[model samples]
Target: MSELIQTYWPMIVAALVLGVAVAWFVFSTSRKTRVTGTSRDVLDEGAAPAERNKALIDSAPAATPMQPAGGAAATPDATGDDLTRIKGLGPKLAATLRDMGVTGFAQIAAWDDAEIDRIDARLGRFQGRIRRDDWVGQAKLLAQGEDAGFAQRYGKLS
Candidate 1:
């Protein structure tokens, strides 16, 4: 065992150095951005308003729902279809939409130009995709359960 260790000592040292380098790279890159709050502070559901507000402002921005003229927040329907069924919406985009309180094809189908603009602004990198993809038109068909029509127009909903 001593002879084998001596034989491969240089290689073993190289491997240890390589492993340390890779570990350092991974850990350095994987460090989460240093926000103003701790994970516990952010995760506390019943935190006081001051802490909650601090956490909210320090966290990454997410989609914010556009309220109607009545000032009541629009919520997604409980029986809404899986939004990922829409051609352009992958799981990530669907989750983002859900986070924004968008559920149900009918809600999307009913969006006017102004509402679409407002919501598009909140979509970050996905802005203008709604109009580009004709989501409203596709949504109208989907809401009506017109799979055949939707498929004909937008291809398969994969």
Candidate 2:
């Protein structure tokens, strides 16, 4: 047993670290509430980015989680624009953006240079992808319904 402990100590230590990380992630996520604007439905559709951001900032405190009277969650939480439509963005990146309160093409399209830099700093391994992939350009095309141009530039969207 003593010999085994010496040989496997590194693995045991790694497992313990992983366990702590998972627990911290779970606890942190559970404690974070989704901040929303006065009209999530309207804000997500056809609205310009600056207007949307302004509204969200002004109305964030008034918004609450959408729990139906019937004790079920709202459908909006599960719905958003298909972010994967942008070529370089994968599932993990999309989830990270969602966690950061991004949901629609319009939202991403609206990011200014400052916002891009700010967001890029938080992307960890995905840093610079927003600029490298031209997320704003791709999102602009999609948000404006330029399918042919988007397909030509970034491949076909499903």
Question: TM-score winner among the candidates?
Answer: 1
Cα lDDT of model 1 by residue, 1-158, tens digit: 99999999999999999999999999998986766754565347985657767898899877465454333333446765788877777788887777766777877887887778877887888887898888889888988889999999999867
Q: Tell me the TM-score of model 1.
A: 0.54
Instruction: Supply the global lDDT for candidate 2.
Output: 0.80
Against the hidden reference, what TM-scores do the models get?
A: 0.54, 0.50
RMSD of each: 13.0, 22.6
Worst 10 residues of 1 by lDDT: 66-75
Model 2 C-alpha lDDT per residue in residues 110-132, reported as the tens digit of each score: 77787788778879999999999
lDDT of each: 0.78, 0.80
lDDT of 1: 0.78
lDDT score for residue 96 of model 2: 84
